[model samples]
Target: MHAEPACETSLSTPPSARWPVVPLQPAVREAAPRQPATRCSTCSLRAVCMPADLTSTELQQLDTVVLTTRNVHRGETLFRAHDAFQSLYAVRTGSFKTVVMHRDGREQVTGFQIPGEPLGLDGVCSGTHSCDAIALEDSTVCIMPFGQLETFCRESRRMQRHLYQLMSGEIVRESSLVMLLGTMTAEQRLAAFLLDLAARFQARGYSGAQFNLKMSREEIGCFLGMKLETVSRMFSRFQREGLVEPNGKQIRIVDLEGLARV
Candidate 1:
């Protein structure tokens, strides 16, 4: 699920002031030429992506339909707000965050994406994207053209069902995030956030109790609706209380139940 700000809010600014800053890096290099779709069936994320319910012959057909693979550098914008929606992307590596730039010029983080996650669903409703998808680190993605997907779904009952599931999950995730922002205390929110990340990692067959925090502390605070200092203080408190062992970006859950109690 992605977390969006309650409103046009910035941790450091007056309510009316806009958040200032953008990735200052130069444009990313162009992506490599398109590769064969055979890569899709063999992708580790096959279960989470296109090949989930496809037979060998179906997978072969899929290879012809996936548009291309793309490489994105850290700080690069994959697609900007209002960009025409053409495809949905599955993260093949690294991570990304979707952001919505406010009319006042502030930016609100909408969601963080990891491997196996599909992005660009927001465009389904409006035809144009509602936010910018930016890479949090060097990443690669498999592009599935939405038009092709729709046609395929019409022909494959399993694929159609899976597409419905993805859409339904996205809606549920957004609702839960809204609740998290409205009713939870800061500590409770942070605790739940960590638990959710752990659960997601475990689902992907990674260690659930320990992992690296790919996003920066400030970014975490921004997403959590807290100041950077507040995020730091909470992490320190968690460590002192023996709930977690955080060393820089590395975090190990020492007491998962204790954290849940927070």
Candidate 2:
């Protein structure tokens, strides 16, 4: 047979030598949402919530202990009655209302909390929460683990004294509420409430003369121990008397002294 026409067989060429190898890039991934870390050293409410005299070292320690923060949506309960207490929460934003439910299903509003206030003190005594702490608006809180806080308190005499002061303040608040309910008239009670709010807001560097009311009239009545109708009437009367200007939830204290006199 005539020499098989020299067939060029390229099968002997290695595949790797024939083609350029390209490295594959890692598959792209979507980033997850980030959780905000608590930084007490730079917090605006540090002056209000934390002690003024804390050294930089103490503040850094606080930041480590208050590493976690929680968001509580409007009308959601932060802690229900009888829940095991592990942390004390400091209000970082918005407000809360503490409520207690009776066997008959009646809800009693105990107190309202604004920014820079502390919660879960009641749990300290019994190791469980005594009432439901519901958010009045979308809110955030710095969670201080109680065990860590206790250890810190033991180390820092200033922090320990501050904790004792906070407890004493709670007792005073309860006593004041009892006095308001027992001795004051409805109008006086309302006046005292407004003035108290003014002072608190003022302390927080807000406009004390005018502010929005987060609590509803019905909730206000529940707290003030008055009927809803009575609370509405009182608000109307205050408006007519030019003591306060109430346009829905917005309140402008037209005559601070006059309201105080009531």
Candidate 3:
């Protein structure tokens, strides 16, 4: 989520006058791929992904549990449904969408995950993944081996509490989605979805008013239990009413109060 600062070197001076040129050397072979950083204590997302109030010693111990990271490309499945689940993944960068396929072959998007979110919780109880987690963009995830995590959790009360909270959060999210699907209108569902995204982004140190949609309208519709056309219409209506402004996949909430009232 950190943006590379723009290089702002002045070009007023000629290159020859600004610095001395060195003679070219023999060309070297391509370097090996760089490994991602695995230290949780130094990670920018530790606050969001790890348990709070963890001492330096605790963080170092936790780092031992998360020993590696895996990169998943856009549109690629991180893990398919029914895969034997061995580890939980914490999003280090980018986002993902979890999908469940019906017997009729229709795919339903269950949830969208941003950076710092956890995936693979669906398999905690059954020991087999119940859905597919697909990367929405080229992303990296810290792999926490569940066995080691469980052992560590037993030793650290804080970690055990945090693990329980994560499971509770998953239950609450699913229940809320059920309520939305069963009791809410399409407009209300979409409004709540947008508001929820805004709040999540704000919690992650991003702007609440403006952000790009990582999931497509069709994906959103699937998650919201609405048709693609209905999802598009809702966005158009929100724009027309001056509650939001949409340009392609980008959205800006122009009137937070108005959107809340929807």
Candidate 4:
């Protein structure tokens, strides 16, 4: 059964730090416009809404508007590093990888974006983005104006809580990545990555143990701090051990328990 939207949280995120609502602005209508045909590049009701829930009137307004759709080709920037953090993006269709370059010009991939996932959210202060978000395939995104959304969030107690909840999870994910890349062996890292992806997909309503990998072995290696050759070898090693049946992009965790053991 689909879950009822969680009650919005009331948090102490200081509204003074960001955009505050003003009287000069036109009063937001009770019924607003919504984009027709919520496409993959367009967010549906679940993923984007997590940072907050919409009132019935707001939903009606949203459902009436037409959202802009833009295609970002593979390896192209959706937004560059240090760009003005003006918008929050939702992966409507396709996938994205966020990367940051080191002082020495090495690229470190920060995270991957899947459908229904929100991005560019961690940027708020200083109005500058810290990383480059790139499309892995031809991708589409829902560009939500950050200032307006934050203004709405300030008024809605629930929305504020949701935003923090989302941010907190991102922090946890990044911290865990640090531990994984810092110490785990190649085999262990690969297994952990798969398991992590499985659980995440499951939460989003897909079969947890079975899914196609949108990232190539090389990209996975980049994220994991391993070489492309090391990633390939680990995959072969896992397959030989009967822990997974990887057929091209298709990967089935034949022995999830076994993989986790590594």
Those runs of model 3 whose alpha carbons end farther than 4 Å from true positions after fitting are 1-36
* Residue 36 accuracy (lDDT) in model 1: 45
- Please give the lDDT score at residue 21 for candidate 4: 26
After superposing candidate 1, which stretches have Cα over 4 Å from the reference?
Answer: 1-38
Name the lDDT of candidate 1.
Answer: 0.78
Query: Once all C-alphas are superposed, what RMSD does model 4 give against the true structure?
Result: 11.2
For candidate 2, write residues 1-262 as lDDT tens digits: 1111011111123323422223333222232232565699999998998899999888888888888788888998888776777789899889999976655556768799999999999889867777789999998888888999999999888789889988999999877876776677778888999999999999999999999899998888778777787788889999999999998898999999999999
Which regions in candidate 4 have their CA more than 4 angstroms from the true location?
A: 1-54, 61-67
TM-score per model over all chains: 0.86, 0.86, 0.86, 0.77
| Residue pairs with backbone atoms closer than 3 Å in model 1 (clashes) | 2-111
Clashing pairs in 2: none
Q: lDDT by residue for model 4 over 1-262, one digit each (tens)?
A: 1111111111123223212322232222222222434632234434544434567655444433324445677887877655656677777678899876545566667688887678886567556666788898888776667766676667666667777877887878877876776567778888999998898778777888789888887778778777777788889989999999899998999998899899
User: What is each predicted model's overall lDDT from 0 to 1?
Assistant: 0.78, 0.80, 0.81, 0.67
Among residues 3 or more apart in sequence or in different chains, the pairs in candidate 3 whose N, CA or C atoms overlap within 3 Å are none
How accurate locally is residue 191 in candidate 2, as Cα lDDT from 0 to 100?
A: 91
- Against the true structure, candidate 4 reaches a TM-score of 0.77
